[model samples]
Target: MIKFANYKKLYLIPKAQGLGLSKKLMETALSFAFEHYEQCYLETMHELKAACILYEKFGFTLLNEPLPATKAGKFNEEIVPLEDVNGETITSDEINQTESTIEDLATLKTIFKEDGTVTAGNASALSDGGSALILMSESYAKEHGYTILATVGQHAEIGCDPLYMGYAPFYAVESLLNKTGKTIQDIDLVEMTEAFSAQSIPVKKNLNIPDEKFNIYGGAIALGHPLGSTGSRLVTTLAHALKQEDKQTGIATACIGGGLGIALMIEKGVGL
Candidate 1:
């Protein structure tokens, strides 16, 4: 289930005031809230009605209403191209991958729920592949002259109802943000496993991640989901993606079977 949080006030340090930091801070905080929380409450005095206008401009509404409704097709259309792009980069001979054309997906038959959008065209393919990571402590890396692309930041796991398994990433990411004292605005890129279009769409919407910053190289739906290697694949791709984009921070998350979700934060190494 989705959750909510409230921010009753926002204060700026004396030295940081009057330099237009409040707007930036408020935007960052609100964007994070909208992404990670189901609802957000902001309390301000009547004298601050002008401030309320700012909040409304950022998508705040009376009684914490939900965001506008979105159709599954909108997400499907957007996702298919990303998957095709990612598919082009795969060179492993062990795995057989195929591009998902929008025209094909539009005509494919649903295989999951009756009349549902879930279909063979948009689901992750069962495949064979292997992935591994060599992890070392920061001190050890420095001592050994290792080239660090990124450092692990925070990790979180959460449990949810099995019926909504795909949404597990939302909760897991929320927990990671809270633990690290970070916000979605702080994340420069995200690599979420696209087990299915139906699952990935909701998670992306709830997280409020931008198209340019999420799964830029496509995802499991197109690249094929080698279940045992998916996690390592995500981590490996995320590290390369961050460096390629010249970004400093990223998160990789996925929903697991049996009502569980997982997320890990990564930050680029200093001076690299």
Candidate 2:
């Protein structure tokens, strides 16, 4: 028999209420459940309306005592604003480009497949941008008196069924971890391209990546996916993110057309 636990008496201090800490806590709890249990349950008083709503938002359905196990289906909808290393929002004008603004949830319309959950509001935007990075050997950099941000580590690529191409990242990343003799726990951060909600959600679940360690910034769905430059773009962003967050290791992975996925790991430079 599957067993579930009731997480109660979980309350945030007054000062922490409005900072989205509740959602983060909930995400952390659910992530643990997803990793260890086939199903998870929680019981909360109805008086906590906001908490109830948050539970429902994470795919919990009300039941008498314990809620049934439900997978979180909402991804790509929460578009984090673009922030710099110092955590300041970067305005479009500052970059000489206009960022796409998301429409209000109520007014957003779904396109493509009939009765489809994928909508214009939730899908990745076709973007136009260029990203570049300079790579040099550690010895060469030190000899040249240049600062090193990070060092590229292992890389892995794998193929999967084209029809379920979105899942390519899971296989690719798994292979990468095995090749590097590391597990998901070793990764400090991850930059998995959000080609669509359909794929990103499942991959995240399978990998059991903690909410805090996943994309801290917005993803392709919000930042826009520049096809040709996306790989470089993800790596560039990952490198900066590692340095900014003072993290040691990170992986950048993306699903390619025709059923291929690739993952690359990078370690923060030493003494930098």
| Candidate number of the best lDDT | 1
Q: Candidate 1 regions off by >4 Å? A: 1-100, 112-116, 270-272
For candidate 2, write residues 52-121 as lDDT tens digits.
2232222211111011111121221222345554656733312112232222432455444354344444
Could you give candidate 1's per-residue lDDT for residues 1-272 as a string of tens digits? Answer: 00112332322332322222223332442234223111111111122122322322221111011111011121221221212223443223222233334455556675434654445554665544556787888889899999887798779999975555567898999999999898898889999877665456556766898867788666676556764677888888788777766899999998876557999999877431
Q: Which stretches of candidate 2 lie over 4 Å from their true place?
A: 1-103
Model 1 alpha-carbon miss at residue 105, Å: 1.4
RMSD (CA, angstroms), candidate 1:
19.6
Q: Each prediction's Cα lDDT score?
A: 0.59, 0.58
Question: For model 2, how big is the CA root-mean-square deviation?
Answer: 17.7
| Model 2 TM-score relative to the real fold | 0.63
lDDT for model 2, please.
0.58
**Which ten contiguous residues of candidate 2 have the minimum total lDDT?**
61-70
RMSD of each: 19.6, 17.7
